[model samples]
Target: MPEAPEADLAGFVRAHDPDRFLCTLFAPAAARPALFALTAFNHELARAREAASNPIAAQIRLQWWRDAVEEAAAGRPARRHEVATPLATAIGAGLLDPAALLAMIEAREAETEEDGLETEQDFVAWLRGTSGGWSAAAGRALGADPEAAEVLRALGAAYGLAGVLRSVPAHAARGRCLLPRDRLAATGLSAESVVATPHAPTVGALAAEMAAEGLEALRGARRDIPRGAVAAALPAVLAARDLMRLAAGREVPAPRGIGDRLAVTLAGLRGRV
Candidate 1:
């Protein structure tokens, strides 16, 4: 396996996952490596499909990560690659949960399927495994107890929904749709229509409604995370901002301005998201 470009996992996080990298700035120094490791792992999973030549290749790639998770969980050295090296350390130190890691890997399989999400419930369940699982693991790594970790899991689902909305265009490019098929049909759009005309006014309307729901979820998530676990929850702030931008007819995954950075920094200082 190719090693991480370098030992500094932060470089990978900074380049590929700047939002999480920004959040990592607020984490304790000793905990930052694990944060970088997990974030890098997530970035890898997120891009696996695009990086692969075909769906089968993508599943094979994801299976490799799954095996790495099993190796780490079994207390074996799965450190041949850069991510696996630090990830194994995190698992060994018991700061991360193998189950959560497995869940994340499992959830990415949805992307490989020709059938998009059939219902809102399906979308939520997918998020529950992807970003939701990641946030819960990050919260626990930052010392959240079981209850708070569960809260973080829900918050992460909301965040993941916003992320999917932001990536509508990208998925369309791949002739895929991540929105619930029923909801898409409610807007007079089908899975094929969404892939064909991603920016249709009806699609925008549906995306707006979904964005509003995500914002509401973020509002409900407030006061759920404790001060110690707030850093992991800060992505909820980013999620809220993304939802609002989506509402305003802006392309998401856009560049973060100084104001955005300041907002996150302030939230971190206040120990809340």
Candidate 2:
């Protein structure tokens, strides 16, 4: 095996983010190395997009990140990017699933660029494409067949949607609103109001709606995947699901709002897997 990258992808996966670590536990051991690298690349990319000193520069950097992901999908890794190194390693494994990865990058790019979600459809597409994409990639790494992969993708999306809903307040603080602007308007809630007061009842109601939709989607997905993998991943999903429920009830904090639920998710994944 190649020597581990300086970032040490596996250690990052193990040491940070309980929800992601919990979700990764069900992945086939054969896929862990590549999966860890892919995830590490994404984590670094997300942080960089948010932390760049200049906002314009941050957008440009995020664009470059998208280009790199596109290159990975094309089987030609972008050579100079730091995150690209480990990302390319994962791509080389032939287990990283380019379609899902590319979709995720594209969705992230859109989220970085948008002022606010103009429509419910746009918001749904972003969630299904990004988080759903991550779930699909995870499923592809662990599942034995295409059908299994599809089911896993849906479950991943369901779980991811819950996370997104729980982070509504944080997204608002950053001047980005993931909830549909049109839907908020329908409820007489302005995006400005949400930004001003991230804890509005309308925001809580919208988050609850999104979480409910995710649960329905997950139920549909669960019927198709293998029982063993489904059993393994369900605990994490349920934990996230519960957090969504709590956020809907106006019980959690901001983006880190799901911290307690994440602990439950980790316990559930370890116990079940």
Candidates' C-alpha lDDT: 0.85, 0.62
Q: Which residue pairs clash in candidate 2?
A: none
lDDT score of residue 53 within candidate 2: 60
- Model 1, residue 144: C-alpha shift (Å): 0.3
The estimated TM-scores of all candidates read: 0.94, 0.77
Q: List model 1 lDDT by residue over 130-174, tens digit each.
A: 888888899999999888988988888888988889888788998
What value does the lDDT take at residue 225 in candidate 2? 53
Q: Count the backbone clashes (under 3 Å) in each candidate.
A: 0, 0
Q: RMSD for each model, in Å, please?
A: 1.7, 4.3
Lowest summed lDDT window (length 10), candidate 1: 1-10
Q: Against the correct fold, how does model 1 do in TM-score?
A: 0.94
Tens digits of per-residue lDDT, candidate 2, 1-273, equal 344564466677666544565555555666666667666666755565467665466667767666766677677844554457667766766767666676676676665553656888887777666656665666566553677666555565566566666666777777656677888898888778887877877677766776666665555555455543443255335535454565457454433346555564554455332
Give candidate 2 regions above 4 Å deviation: 1-7, 52-59, 70-82, 227-236, 247-273
